[model samples]
Target: MAACQTEKEEINFPKTDLSNMPMIPKPLKTIPTGSAFGLDAGTAIYTSTTDPAFEKVGRFLSENIKSKTGLELGVNSSSEAKLERLIYINQSDSVDLETPESYQLYIKKDSILLNAKTAAGAFRGIQTLQQLIPTKSNDTLTDHPLWVIPSGKITDAPKYGYRSSMLDVARHFFTVDEVKKYIDALAYYKFNTLHLHLSDDQGWRIEIKSWPKLTEVGGASEVGGGEGGFYTQEEYKDIVAYAADRHITVVPEIDMPGHTNSASLSYPFLHYAGAETPRVRTDMKVGYSSFDAQKDTVYSFLDDVIGEIAAISPGPYFHIGGDESHVTKKSDYILFVEKVEKIVQKHNKRMVGWDEIAQADIDSKSIVQLWNSADNALKAADNGSKLIVSPAKKAYLDMKYDSISEFGLHWAGYIPVDVGYNWDPETYVEGISKENILGIEAPLWSETISNGTELEYLAFPRIIGYAELGWSPSDHLDWEDYKVRLAAQVPYLEAMQINYYPSKLVDWNKE
Candidate 1:
């Protein structure tokens, strides 16, 4: 994982078909050594008897398959007879395989079997099965489609426990259904975490029953000076459920201390007289408005907000955004973050914040999201805080892929698809080793993205890059081989109607 193993020796993937197939986020291990498995009218899926949890997984896969192939593939428990043209899933009691997400898949001529320790691992295997479906003519998925796939044995598990993606909705609000679309796409790439940036200077996107004005006033405008919207408690709960059903955890973020213009405008008591008069910012400027950290009422307001957010979001980690606070005094910033951490802990939620939290008296058990210097990340890791590496230079999907790009910013430099795919999370920083690392995250700040189409255009291809980096082993990553597989994914993406920026580095016609 050292700088993606120096591009001179790019990694390779399993050699099976020279035809169309989605290739990014290569599995941990794959070997094509058996006869082809045909997905036809007779295919059936089976679940584990020991764990009834897989019944849901079986139904999910069966529905997707039915939609794509127009085949009513049967789904039954292990008690049923093992039939030909089958996809089998079972739980293993083996002790050496400690990770719950670890799984082994064997695709043979007549039967494809997947074995995992838990239902979660089995669900990850289902993602791979979808990828195995042919990409060519993917738009015309039918019973007669070429359902043949090369027989292979794949032993796979994620390299990082917290493979994540962040969506900044406050800068440009997205509806609940749109957010669900984003979650489904990321989950397909093996990303397990969904960090929702729900608050910023432009908008506040979640309801607070105690403070009804937060959404009524603060959620009334976005960055472009348009009417904004906020999610009701029930809507937010549905989002959480949708994400959990797909094996993705929702990490709701309430950017506080800084990025509080919307809040200050709603509740004037949170206003600092020294700062600019509170107003919803239409421009993408940072570090201006801040909460009155010293005011006891401000803490009381945050207490209510945090309690409400934590109640809806069942995820263990609650993200208290503590980044970019230029207007707030250093002492005030520290005190603000310190109080936020205690509030989060009191609600029985683990705290997560930007790397700047390392500068304050933050909780050691909290997870620090690194978006700036490696020195800051190393410092946080050295102090016993887990690190979520998302250096803006390489990991920021919001950055344009090149200078000529029509969408996204270039402050982090143009992250070409190769540049995005080549940097490994494990070795991106010199001093912060895997032990210090909690996982990897790619943040898509929606400064330029206003809709799901724009978000997909910025995310794809690069998002898949981060997905592979977090799942595939360090030694297994190779840019040269990966580029080929990466190009192959174009057809599948097109079939799904994903609006992706086609990089010149890739030969799309090759697929």
Candidate 2:
């Protein structure tokens, strides 16, 4: 193991004066600004898109723009506006945008053009455009005169195809509204995937129609014994659709075999230690309980659970929680994993599991999400399976920044922002390069995040680093420069009313 890999890298807030303009997960390359285009009521969002979905995206963007600026920017296909203050969000024929998420934005004195090859790209560009639209005041639903974008050009695409953030909703059940807020925040940071940890030992979040008791009994209470809530099938669908509209694929995780206490509680015969009645766990210990790997009925239960979640989840991947199976025998663990893998495959979804699953007999195409060291990551990648590098020490948002920090765990090293952004996912391990890397993910295991403010406090600045690592190109990555850029976002974060922790390492005092 490399000495520096484990050693905590210190933060060096850049020496030079950096731009105060906020661009979280900054664009690849932006040129000098010219004249600015101020948005007004007459401005129209012009797009020749026939697809209702893309048109809906335009409407969504228009609505948000209108909300920020108090300008009713109508979505018009007929390009006949008098002033020509047009926001063109269209699929371009001129530029060869090879990636679905690639976009080019050109801001001129009169009009702004955002072009891409696909709706996904256009949506990403909208996120960038939103960042460019300054908040003139801290008041919500108030008009902002500075809802203007400086004249510049930005060609942006993610460095890794799958930039993800996982929210462990089961540990602390967040409402649908809360989840949407999280999705919007993730979209702002340009993250493309929201891996929803819908199931855990404490509770089951999504309504599984085939398994009614899973929610009726298992979802009734959360970790601290609050009346837990579960997203109904319709509500879950709404979340999937909402995420899709924002160009974020929702990867739902229904962890089984180990995080199966909730499941076992719902159906007592499902078997952890051969069938004793169980209750939803109120504690935080792992591997003390799991599904009966020996039972054929347990396999049937998996089929039902996996089938329901897979049916609702439109994304390609389904995450099976295959971590910390300390209680199950090694053979049983491997057996259970193999059975679950087949069930996922039967539903036409690719398998995703924690690094522990790499030890099981899984298909080469399955994705392994790593929260520990690189050993399992390297092992899985070597076998042709891709790895999402979310090492707990680096990417787990729940870990406290330093000893003085109030809200998170210290097990994963104190990850200040620089430590979060310093490591390159592609070069983290010896053998793992860009090819073996699927993307990078920052996971917030919600043991401590009980409310929206707490969640934001732990997630921001650090999660911003996750976005930068996944989006910004290798050459553009510099922690010193990034800390400055990150510090630049304080006003933006403040204006948005997001309760982010102002790091002691950076100067947040107004210049």
Candidate 3:
């Protein structure tokens, strides 16, 4: 596919003045049109079959059409009835789809039907439909503002299954509402996974009923000391629910052994010697305090904490952070891995840890989020452990955009938006197969980020690129084309009232 294609050839819609303006330009040929099943201009009816979930999707479509074009869309859930212009969703089709920008829309003149194997697919289709809506004044272009149902077939699926982005809530706390907003934005861009780094030396975000001090005392900190706040169980639940509705899985990370300052402060017994400790420093850095993995009590405590998190999180995976554990005594690290593996199995959830955890004789069921280097990723892949490539040199968004910026931290290399977009995951680890590759994730560490605005400034434009790299086929990604699409997305961000650094304005040559 060429880098660009005209919209008229792809989808037949009345060309309006606004259509030529490039604000809503035609999709690139590489951008698969989910309309593979076929579509017709005639009105279509939709109905649900054995699966009631289809009925919910139908209702959502009806509501969206009503709001966007003031058109009343009819919906029926009966399986026996044959209706023209209709759709059927059965129980057998409830599979998950995690594409970056592909949707499945089935339509015919007599009836139109659409079914997403998963809610994520359904949401992506909705976003595509939104793009089809005319951006110009409805009254000037036509008598009715309703969009013409473009004819075509779309049987689309994502190239990657793990389209994700990681957020560091520990360094700088964001409000529950702000977290929801980020979820909405991620979902809007077709990213399916939201990795929340909930714990670090800086702070512990989630509430633990048994260990109340984890939140009560660890949640808030002194003003100037860089101590931040934490989220209550109620607030965390609310955020999870909100993400669920948007078809985005919330993967919570509780860094262990190393990033356990907050955990130690809350439950002194979790420390190496079971010595009581007060609230720790807010500086975002590697933690020295670690749980005594050799101790049985430590595993019990982890089981309890994981149990609390699992109860609230509906996702199938749990992140038992095993990264940067400098305090791990050689024997203790091995025992810790053994115990953690058992606990992960007990919970019936796959364990995900940083690449460093691979050294602890962990099970293959564990998924490794490779950060330090490709060597770790290769080792994990060789051991049959799935890996999410997030090498710090290329995928870490927390690094300053340039070396000149005095963002407080100097250790992490400066990386700009272009540098992030230029990173190709397939090439990151030489021998790793794409099948073994789970997906790509951009980690926004919060050493210098103090608040939500700073977080947005660093995450936005770069995140969009990562989303594309994770979603689109590697051969199809074009930096120039992405910049075009990214330019169009800026206004949407503005309308949404987000503070993100503009990629176009950032002078990559300055360094």
lDDT agreement with native, every candidate: 0.83, 0.80, 0.67
Residue 85, candidate 2: C-alpha displacement in angstroms: 1.9
- Which ranges of candidate 1 are over 4 A from the true structure? 1-22, 77-83, 135-146, 509-511
Candidate 3 lDDT (Cα, whole model)? 0.67
Full candidate order by TM-score, most accurate first:
1, 2, 3
Better model by TM-score: candidate 1 vs candidate 2 = 1
The lowest-lDDT stretch of 10 consecutive residues in candidate 3 is 33-42
Task: Tell me the deviation in Å of residue 419 in model 3.
Answer: 1.4
Residue-level lDDT of model 2, residues 47-166, one tens digit each, is 756655567768989888776767767786565434446788777765557688888888865578888878888888888888777666223222423344666788788888999999
Model 1 residue 289 CA deviation in Å: 1.1
- Global CA lDDT of candidate 1, please? 0.83
Over 166-199, each residue of candidate 3 has an lDDT whose tens digit, in order, gives 8888877878877888887787666788999998
Clashing pairs in 2: none
The 10-residue segment of model 1 with minimum total lDDT is 4-13
